[model samples]
Target: MIMVFGIGDYGLYEPHEGHFAMVGQEMIFQGNWITPHLNGSPYLNKPPLLYWLIAFSTKVFGAHEFAARLPIGLAGWLGILIAWKWTRQLWGVSASRIAALMLSVTVGWFLFTHQILIDVLLSTLLLASNYFLWRVIYQPQSWVYWWAAYISLGLCLLTKGLIGIVFPLLGFLVLGLVRQDRKLIRRLRLFRGSLLVLALILPWFIAVEQANPGFWHYFVVNEHLDRLLDRRFPPDYEVSQISAFGYLIITALWCFPGILFLPSVLKFTWQEWRQGFRDRASTLERQYSDGILLLAIAAILPVIFFLPFSSRLIYYGIPAIPPYVILFGGWYSRYQTSVSEEQSDQPLAISIKQSYLPANFREKKRNKVVTIYSAIAICLGICFVSTLFFHSLIVQSLPPVINNSDTKLLMFIVPITLGLGWIISGIGIVRQSRFALLPVFLALIVTYISVVQGFIAYQDVRSSKTLIRAADSCLNIDTLWIFEGSREIGTAGAISYYLNQGQNYNAKDIAEHHDTGWEKGNSGRIYRHVMVLSDGGKNRIPPNFPGSPPAYLIDRQQLQSYWNSDRPVVFITDFLRQFNDLDDPENRNLPQGVGKPSLIINNRKLYLNAAAQKFECNF
Candidate 1:
């Protein structure tokens, strides 16, 4: 699945992916490592840590979609490996595999890993940090473990900024408050560890500040504080606390069935945790129980920390995933024990088995029977409806896919058939054994991945790169114009990366991010290639722009410049044109829009040119 499709091949996936690609390409093009400049302006929306990783990858691989996303994909895999190893220590060898599988199937981990985003890397680092911190609490006399926690904390800071460190810090404080792990604090080596973290990140921060004055205020005050406090100038996000239901919904979508096992996780964690405080438990049992308690607290802290924030995206809930999966894996391990005829592996699982074992059929047997059959029924029901009514769903509820790329009947039919086969197999297994639930569940997830990959491939490259492909034809005409038109689905960033493969690619003309409008092209020089959107989805125009600027009026000066060009000046405008022109007419792609000038020149753009500067930017 990893090798099957290109990141840019599936469309830049709109603003988030496009932004990452653009920054990476720019980092390579400019050879400026300290300050990540985009479109000749300091693009400080995010810290340069992720950009540096991408820059290194692009430097080695030459800015391909695969190269841009390779690091995060690797990070995701590393996260799974770490989860597997750590779970083995907390649970057992079998639980380790289950924990790793849980993460692999998580929608958030899978998607974010493949896509070029900071969160995958951030999530991995946080997982490691919290894992080591727990080691610091339970496994004493380990200086290396404390260092690992602090080192990961620093890297996390570089990846997303203050929130990176803030998450672990809050989780630590929460653990200390709840578990009273005070000795762990003394062992943290605070002074040495603080210096180590600062040493790793201080050079980059200093370099950026020296290069761009007032970066501290914009980065710390605006990007960090204002964004979090919902007080940033120009207000990027609305201010309000999220309801508990919102948290539940976000976690449900992210963790899915595993999250549904929360009650079981809480029950097991609570029981083990209570035993740790009792004097009768052995040293090893107390150590294992303490680890579980720490994980539970770590999982809950992020949700509580973000509760007061007025603005939050569902992805921000990523920090909770590692702990939740660990706990879920424990429940699964315990469930396997009660059902299996073999001896349990962990002491806790042994205890659970002792309580669970009964003369006749156990409650777990009844629960397993009900749950597995109910799941099978739901799967069959959804598959039946999808296979039978796919056409109707497309006509009404669903958005149309390009090139008649509709979901095939076989796609639905084969999965449903396999599911029924599993159900039948599961029923047979339940008579003598209940371990079939594990294989059946694995088959379901593998089937899901296969189906998703098939749909992605069927969707094809043209569906995603419409505007970029449209622009591809104009390169022969020598009508060079910096992209001033927005390409939704973030084809713009993909465009910048691909189009800039030429040795003479303009740093100014290709708005690496959103257009700073400081490019020399504003002086009006006619050249080759189509230019569209350095990042201007917010600068939406009519389907027929320049001719009719109903939503966003083009500057008469820029319009005249393009019209008077010696050769045909090709530019695709009217973002709404995609509605009629593209094959996927109904797909309303999401684009990044905040902190940008509208098609009509706003006050900031005016001020930049207010100093008798000639405004010659060709849209």
Candidate 2:
């Protein structure tokens, strides 16, 4: 419920969400599911799993935000359930519940639920693959689970390309080498498994390749290899990647308060290590140790894979989160019902075998539990006080675009809610109460939901939905929508999506043309390639796609020509730089023919040509 709550309350987020949603919407518009299209051009960057799901959802739920986001939400919910079931098998019910909640409220998981990104879905499929692989390791005779593992892996490939196969294979390789266990690899039936994977994924690849030639080169070399080396064309996302230290910071934030319990887990690990060397471990002990090792490797391997690459995004480590939370759940549950004496003397596997807490476990484990609870409480308290005092500085330090009252309010509320919850849980822990950690879990859920609400409040600036709708109202079949500025893909996509409802375009008519020299005609100079599909080599009066007439990124010459022309033209400017122009009189580059904007909303200015005044418009 929390994952899907109010997903449709705000418009799709600019760029990423808007980009995917537009592609999915276009799939339905074009009646083409095999090849994803954007602005009437083939978008070969990502696989069709997310687009296919969104297109399916849009069909069932209508073309809206709810439909676009529902698929990711369901994926996230399934991820939580998978974590719960896997943890229950490794640990017990209490641990499984804890693991599920931890995975649910983590910053990355929670944020991605509301936003339409493939990372959450990709991580979930990978986690499912790992879970099935775990089952195969324990029950090698169960060939059904083995096939299931390969099937999940194939789905992962469809979700994000090769990483689906690469990530899991890497984890399995590291696991086999660490444990020197060849039996698991032998039992994997490599020949059969490879065929199974290929069978699942090859049909779509072949079909898409046949539909669009040169897809194999672009999808594999440019998208994957060049992307890994930071040399992909378009060079759009390089700025979003972070440093090694930033990757660590992102992972920590994604894991959040659970990461703070690392010291306790480390102490337990040290104790287990000493116990393993001192005595001949039982079979159960060995299995428990193997499970722990597997989880650890699975959690860290994705980071290790992407760490050396410069093209790693903050969410690149999302696949690492599931195993980390499960590991935390396993150890925390052990401590919760641990024996009275020092944990160092006892094998950690004993706790894993136990199904319920002993009657006399409470008073003995109180001190350790209280210590963990109090330490977290103190940390939350410090964060709360710091936020109260330093919030102004924090907001001032943020980029001017997102430094709004909504973000400020979020800063104040999140820490306070967390600090208060931990304080209450701390008191309960001291009292030897059952379910002391419940408050902390509830608090996290509340904090993330609050975070989403805050983003919705600031959506006017972050999204161009309102502005697009305003422009759509004034636009008609004859009015041409022209997007100005280089990085307005989100606004362009939104205009194409919301305005072009029930409209159709012939894909064969679209042509990609780039302007090389200065303009000698009314066909304005395009900054790059004009994305709009033209009519019979006529770039001046382009054909409409779905909502309105063709929209293109036009240079100053084209702006002047369109402004002076008799045809109705609606110009959408980039938010930040265009707004900056309004502030600086000398730098303002408005053409003499085009006067003041007809509408200005959320820093996005909409300029209308003389012929557009026929329709009454307000901003």
Candidate 3:
């Protein structure tokens, strides 16, 4: 419910959200559920599961932002539940509850919950698979858990790709090597499990490959391998690649507040490591050590896996968040228990503490606890002060980040609130208060809600919905609209979605067909596809954007032809600078007869061909 709160308050963001929202909407409009379509083109970048969920959601809830995001929100909700249940099973109820609370307020998890992307759903599915696999390891006699693990893994495969299986496999491999546990390996039944996974995922792969030849190579080698090696053709994520240090910083931020307890979590892991190596260890002791070790590995593996890759996104560490919270939950639960014991009147509690921990060790433990919270408080304090004093400096430095001081301040509110929360929580922790973490969690929830509300401030800058709506009055069934740009689909997706949906343009008409040449078994002719207008004569689809397919790229000759054609053509471009050139009477860059824009809003403009003047309407 928290994740879903006010989800529809803002318009869908450009590019990412607009892309997915429209693809799912197009699935319903086109009556094609197996293949995902954007604008008029098949979007082969991702699998259809996310689109399927979005289509089903919009079907029941109507075509709107809430419905588009509802699926991911619910997925996030389920992820929280999984964290709670898994933690309870491994640790206890208190830890389980804390884990859920931690995950709900996690910066990356919460932000992605409201997004229209596949990562939240994919991460949730991956978590489910991980939990069920862990269950298989602990309860080897339970075939149900085994089957559930495979099924979830298969769904993960459908959700993203090989990483669905790769992450879990990698984590378990590291766990097995660390423990030298061949028993877990033998219990896996790799042959049968592999067959089950193949059965579940193969049919879709086969069908998609048959539908589009070379899809296997494209998806497997090009998309996966080339992407890993940073050699993807028609490169899409050149701006996304980050250094190793950048990855650490991003991961730390994603796991904020939760990361405040990192030193203790590491300390606990180290203690467990030493315990596991001890000459004398009980079954329960080994079990606890192994569980902590597994959780630690699960939490860090994704970060490690993506560290070497040049292409990375801030949200790529989402799958790691669940285990991270679980680790925090276990450590925090122990800390809370110890505090309670210290305050209790029971002689048994006093004896246990004195025997297990000497006075110096107890003092050191208390100091460590104080140090963690104090460090976080100090850091947050510094951030709050820096942001308050250097507000103008920040706004000037990142001029393109937020359009105005208000939105920049709004963005700053999150960190400010987080800083204050840490300060209060630090006091509570120093006093050994039972609810020390509550204030920070509450602040996270409240500030995130505010962040959602404040997000609308960027609607004009990030979304083209309003601009597209202004042009709606001029549009009709016969109006031809082409987004003119050479860059990746920016607001073009939002424009395409709004234009097609507002005017009741049929899916076929919106996705006006051009020869893709793939159908004639002419592999050579396949180069003449969607995006790029060939340098001289050929056509090529830039791999960067599969979001808005109905949008056609316009070259000089095509622009001149459209301008001179008797039929109505609405030339739309979001690049305001281009509109300036088009408006200049002396600017020969545009066709000779081009005049002022018929409609202009924000950074987008619409020019009416001579034939479109008859259909002109004001905003």
Most accurate candidate by TM-score: 3
Q: Candidate 3 local accuracy as lDDT?
A: 0.69
Per-residue lDDT, model 1, residue 561, is 50
Give all candidate RMSDs, comma-separated: 8.9, 7.4, 6.2
Over the stretch 1-619, how does candidate 3's per-residue lDDT look in tens digits?
7889878887888668888887787777767676666656666878778888888998898878889899999999999998898777655667778899999999888888887777788888888877887777767789999999899889899889998888878877877898798997777777788999999989888887777667887888877898888787756454446788888898888888688779877876566444544556544445555666667777888798888877776678877788888878867766665534434333211222121221222345467656667677766756764666776666676435355767676657866777777777777777766687887888788788777866666566667777767765655545556555423443455566665553333234434443321111112211111222222121122444323334345456876776687766666653423333433322323454768987765665667788778765766
Candidate 1 regions off by >4 Å?
Answer: 1-9, 233-247, 280-282, 338-364, 367-391, 395-398, 403-406, 409-434, 439-464, 482-491, 502-556, 574-619
What local lDDT does model 2 show for residue 575?
Answer: 58
lDDT at 347 for candidate 3? Answer: 21
Residues 66-158 of candidate 1 have per-residue lDDT tens digits of 777778888888888878877877667677878887787766676677677787788789889878877776555787897888889899988
Better of 1 and 3 by TM-score: 3
**Candidate lDDT values, in order:** 0.57, 0.70, 0.69
**10 residues in a row with least lDDT, candidate 3:** 517-526
Clashing residue pairs, candidate 3? none
Shift in Å, residue 356, candidate 1: 10
Better-scoring candidate (lDDT), 2 or 3:
2
Candidate 3 residue runs with Cα over 4 Å from true position:
273-283, 339-366, 389-416, 486-491, 502-541, 544-555, 574-592
TM-score of each: 0.76, 0.83, 0.84
Candidate 2: residue 444 Cα off by (Å)? 1.9
